[model samples]
Target: MAKEIERKFLVSGQRWRTFADEGIAIRQAYIVAQDDRSLRVRIYGNGQARITLKVGHTALVRDEYEFEIDRDEAEDMLRHAIGNVIRKVRYKVPHEGHIWEVDVYEGVHRGLVIAEVELASIHDEPELPNWVGREVTGESQYSNQSMALGISEGARLHQLA
Candidate 1:
């Protein structure tokens, strides 16, 4: 089984931009969004698409299964998604031997920047960059699933930040 182990943080400053690569635009939507498991479809700027199934309740680790799908099928699934489609640009930044994915949200969730670093194991602790602000690892409110489902509330929260 594929396990996803990562830590999430709020981006504090613009320092990360210096090390970030050209970002890729991404659009994703949830087909099944339950508390413990979720099915998501994502389309990238390169026209590639994928459908992922994630199962587990823990924040740091989850069983993940991803499969490539036709872009048209993915778009069709997005239309039937449970919540609002998420739009963001993801940039990869290498820091201290670890690659951090920084997601800059657009559309309704603009101004929200989140950085996530995936680890080989749950015990691994990657060095945090200076631009990383508060750690929001286990916060469900900051999860993309929650944001997509509660668009209005999420937008308001980010606007107030």
Candidate 2:
């Protein structure tokens, strides 16, 4: 099984923009979303698509399987998804040998900005960028699945922690 270990943080300031490239627009929808499993399809800026299956209950690690899919098929799946489509622009920023993926949300999730870094192992400690704010790693309210399903209650646009 392929496992993913990552940490998520709320973006603090605009400093991250200086080190980021022009972001790619992303649209994702969840077909099945539960506490331990999620099935989702994502479409990228250039029309590339992928289907992903994630299983886990922890904040720091999860089992993730993702594969490329036909654009038409992904679109069809999105149409039948259970919740609102999650729209965001993803920027890749490299700092101190670690690449961070920053997601700036759009549509109903507007004003949300989050930064995430994947680690090689559960014990790995990555450098924290100054632009990174409160760590929301295990907070289900900040999870994409929860946000996509519009289940985040009082999820304000402010920096957490």
Candidate 3:
């Protein structure tokens, strides 16, 4: 079982750009958007694709199962996905022995920027960057599943492209 322990934060400023490497464009959609479990398909700009299954009740930790799939299959899954698919550019930034994934949303979610850092353990304390604003861990409203489903009011997300 693969356990994902990570923390999420809102980006406060553009300072993260200084340490960011070239970003990869990502498109993801949810097959199941339930509160306790979800399945998602993600396609990357590099033609890579993956389907992920996550099960958990909390935002901080989850049992994640991911499998690489053919791009065609992933695209097909996206078409059948529930609600809107999410499009974002993911930038990798190495800071203080941890790699942070900063996601810059595009399309209807253009103004949102969120950063996440995975930890070795749930107790692991990652160094917070100066550009990180409020910690949004365990916040359901900020979750990717919620965002993709447009569960929050006023966020215009799109379906499979």
For this target, which candidate reaches the highest TM-score against the unseen true structure? 2
lDDT head-to-head 1 vs 2, winner: 2
lDDT of 3 by residue, 29-61 (tens): 999878799999999999999999999998889
Instruction: Give stretches of model 3 more than 4 Å off.
Output: 154-161
lDDT per residue for candidate 2 within 58-115, as digits (tens), equals: 9798999999999999999988998789999999999888999999988877888999
lDDT of 1 by residue, 1-161 (tens): 99999999988878999999999999989999998999999999999999999999999999999999999999899889988899999999999999999999888788888999999998897888889988888888788988888744553264213
Lowest summed lDDT across 10 adjacent residues in model 2 is found at: 152-161
Q: In model 1, where is the ten-residue run with the lowest total lDDT?
A: 152-161
Give the range where candidate 3 is weakest over 10 consecutive residues by summed lDDT.
152-161
Candidate 2 segments exceeding 4 Å error:
none
Evaluate model 3: give its TM-score: 0.94
CA RMSD (A), model 3: 4.2
CA lDDT of each candidate?
A: 0.89, 0.90, 0.88
